[model samples]
Target: MHNDLPIRKIIHVDMDAFYASVEQLDYPDLKGKPIAVGGSGARGVISAASYEARKFGVKSAMSGRLAEKLCPNLIFVKHRFERYKEISNKIRKIFLDYTDLVEPLSLDEAYLDVTKNKIGLPSATLIAQKIRDRIFSEVGLTASAGISINKFVAKIASDYNKPNGQKTVNPEDVLQFLEELDIRKFYGVGKVTAEKMYQKGIFSGKDLKSKSIEYLEDNFGKSGKQYYYIVRGIHNSEVRPNRIRKSLAAERTFSENLSSEIFMLDKLNQIAEEVSNRLNKSKVSGKTITLKIKYSDFTLQTRSKTLPFFINDKSIILENAKELLYQDSLKNSVRLLGISLSNLNTDKKLSEEPIDKEKKSVSVQLKFEF
Candidate 1:
């Protein structure tokens, strides 16, 4: 079944430094300091770091030891996913107040379909601003919002101005805004793919759109279609619902980037095992797998390959993940690492690569955040 096409009013909302910000809001003393949430122990990893810390080159998933070196005054605290999750629930409730079509990307971000709403606001831009205000007032956290006609543009607009900022990309402005966009900034353009694009001189949306779709497909494979429309301000993705998730993962952040054998491997094993348990509880099996890695400099990479057979075995999944992990050259100690399983038994695959407003069950992550 295809998602019904609608004249959607999509808004993407992302909290600023979710965990670290929340901690700061809770503890006034940590407000201006570079606070990295995790621990300072040798094995401790940062889950999130304040923007102040980011300036000092301290970031999420960095080792405490390394973070200390980068920012001598960096403060490390333990993660409280439960608190973040509770905050997420509050944010979800706020979105539902605007529309039932809310698609959550993480504990701190979501996409809202506000074509229809309880208050019935006439302007989506106003709606986006109102939501941002509500998040700050009620949740005590700053949020950025993007408002647009479709998901892709809206997602990009939200990040146009970050840290308690918001931008609205009217349909008329979509083309111009996209034209100057860096190909690397486009969602789903990971580190590896970005380097490849740069090598080909596909620096901005204009450069990317210059190449024929055929050439892009030949080079980027399945993701070429996404590259084609994103440059033109078109995205056929949907806002999926909260469902019985087939898989889940827990990643770690070191205070500093790490390339050591013991650090990354141990982290992967931890994430894979968590995913296994989530799958087991959901009683779902998947054939396709993905591994996400973020480097020290905040460049991200993902290596995903599909398997012919579906399995819920943890060992099998972890083993394959381990292989994918070591396959990449040790460029830097990874700051962030995560794993996911797709290709579900009851899978939804779109033949047409565009946003479908009819269905909210399945949607594309649309590769560009490589």
Candidate 2:
């Protein structure tokens, strides 16, 4: 089945420690120093760390205090989104010169399909080399590139030689390359899933391939089929350019866990307001409201409720979110609260009526307690 699919030339480009590197590039004194880009306060989290800091086990998402403890000399630089966006725009322009089939995963990474390009380039490897060289020469920044037949493999390959490197996986070598790969490295397989697979004696793609689709489905639900095919090097998902926004979400981790229901409700209201603002800014609404709860122990749970009509109002979203929150009993003190909207009414073909009908606001009373 994998042999029948059309081969593509996908390249995944990722910047090397983007934020920290930018800071080091602009400030000569910070070069080769252990620096982190984010707040230095107790409650602050590290957004990015220089490769030097990474050597000391300091990484993004770790608390500033932890980072400081890990690397005592670590310098924390405040995030400069404007400068990062400026550089990102420059990088994006470089990609646009090659192909229109560019999917930006973030400001620092993107997937480009160069199977057919404006420059009429046939070799994705050569294009990747040129792109990396251009970035260094023009932007004073280094990037890594991964070339493969699909986005998943390409993305993983980009990490093979980090900082400033490239890796290519040919079509004929896809199976062998994937077979030797660790299950933990497979996209979408998180820590919990990997641990589960490990317990089931599936540690690598080779082991995963040995399992039948039925066995995988029976254990992993809908993701089972995905694993079964992907292990055999069969990923057909395309690199969609100009991808549409599907959902909007807002979440916050508290400085301390909250046990009181009143405090939880207040936090939920704040999250709902943020979600509503984002939805309004995007000119979109959704019928599904989900409440995400992260316990003090780090266990996570999400409850969702689908409404009949799309809504962008804070009050309406909060009302539905509250209902979902209470649908399941609280298991532990929550350390994080989040609200999100999905099943977006973005399709013009099936959303004309709902858009008009939901234009007006509908208020719902908020009275609840644990």
Point to the candidate with the largest lDDT.
2
TM-score of each: 0.78, 0.89
For candidate 2, write residues 1-370 as lDDT tens digits. Answer: 2223556789999999999999999998999999999948866778999999999999997878889988999999999999999999999999999999999989999999998889987789999999999999999999999998878889989999998999998876777888899999998999999999999999998899898888999999999977877776666677877666777899988888898767788888899899999999999999988888888766879888888999999999888888887787789998788998988987433211121211111111211110
Q: Which stretches of candidate 1 lie over 4 Å from their true place?
A: 1-7, 243-275, 288-309, 313-341, 350-370
Residue range with the least summed lDDT across 10 consecutive positions in model 2: 361-370
lDDT of each: 0.79, 0.85
Tens digits of lDDT, candidate 1, 1-370 = 2233334578899899999998998889999999999857876767788999999888876767889999998988778889889989998999898888888888998988777777878688888888989988998899999888778888888888998898887655666777788877888998889999999989988899788778999999989966875676556566776643554555666656777756778778888888888888878788988888887766778888889998678899888888888786866767778888888775655434455322322222221110
Give the CA lDDT, 0 to 100, for residue 62 in model 1: 73
Q: Candidate 1, after superposition: displacement of residue 313 in Å?
A: 4.3
**Residue 31 C-alpha lDDT in model 2:** 95
Residue ranges of candidate 2 with Cα displaced over 4 Å: 255-257, 296-299, 328-333, 347-370
